[model samples]
Target: MAENINSIKQKFIIRNKLGLHARPAAMFVKLANTFQSEVWVEFEDDEVNGKSIMGLMMLAAPSGSIIYVSAKGEDAEKALLALGNLVEGGFEEN
Candidate 1:
C-alpha cells in the first residue's frame, strides 16, 4: 500500500570561491530542509546530513573539490536538481 520512492545521487564540484564554508553551507542546509526528501552530501570519505549546517561545514571542501549529493524520498529528483543548480552556480556569491 506504500508508494515507491527512489534515491537519487549526483556529483558536483564546489565552484564558489569560498567553497562550502559557513555561509554556503548554511544556504545548502536551508534549501535542503525545504524538501521532504532526506539529503546527504559526500566529500572524499566523509558523508554528512545535507540539512545540518555543522555537518556540511565539517566536510571542509574547498573550491574545485568534488562532492556527491544524495536524496531519497518523494521529492528526491527535485532536491537534487535544485542543489545541483546551487552548487553549479557558485552559490551565487559572485
Candidate 2:
C-alpha cells in the first residue's frame, strides 16, 4: 500500500527589505522546485502556486506582509519548513 502524507501548511511574514521581489521570487520558485511536493502561497484571499514566478510577483507582498504557504506530497513537511525558513531568513539580501 502507498503511504499517505497530508499536506502541510503554515503562515509567514516577509521580513526582508526588498520583500518578494524578482530575485527573491526566483529564489522561492527555485526552492519550491527542489522538492517533490506541490507548493503554494497565499496572500489574503488569494493563493498562488509556489513554483510560479509570475504568480508570486502578482502578490506585491512588501516588507511585513503576511502570507500563507502549503505543500502536499512526499516532501510536504520539508517543503513547508524550508519555505518558512527562507522567508524568515529575509532572503539574506540585507
Candidate 3:
C-alpha cells in the first residue's frame, strides 16, 4: 500500500539582492526535482511550480518580498524546510 503524505504551506522572504533570478531559480528547481513531491511557490495571487525555472522567474519575487511555499508528498515537510532554508540562507550565496 502507498503511504499517505500531507501537504504543508509556509512563508518566506527573499533576502538575496537578486531575488529569484535565473541562477537562484535554477537552483530551486534542481532542489525541488530531488524529491518525489509536488512543490509550488506563491507570490501575491500568482502561483508557480517550484520545479520549473521559468515558472519561478515569472514570479519576479524581488528582495524582501514575502513568498509562500507549499509541498505535498512524503517529503513535504523536509522539502519545505530545505527550500525555506535555501531562501533564508540567501540561496547559499557568498
- The prediction achieving the highest TM-score against the true structure is 1
Model 2 steric clash pairs: none
Cα miss at 45, model 2 (Å)?
A: 1.8
TM-score to true structure, per model: 0.96, 0.93, 0.93
Query: lDDT per residue, candidate 3, 1-94, as tens digits?
Result: 9777889999999999989899999999999999888999999999999999999999999999999999999989999989999998899773
Writing each residue's lDDT as its tens digit, candidate 1 over 25-85 gives 9899999999999999999999999999999999999999999999999999999999999
Task: Give the deviation of candidate 3 from the true structure as CA RMSD.
Answer: 1.6
Task: Give the TM-score (vs. native) of candidate 1.
Answer: 0.96
Which candidate has the top score in lDDT?
A: 1
Which residue pairs does candidate 3 place in steric collision? none
Model 3 ranges off by over 4 Å: 1-3
Clashes of 2: 0
| Deviation in Å, model 2, residue 23 alpha carbon | 0.6
Q: What TM-score number comes out for model 2?
A: 0.93
* Sequence-dependent TM-score of model 3: 0.93
Please give the distance, in angstroms, between residue 75's alpha carbon in candidate 1 and its true position after superposition.
Answer: 0.3
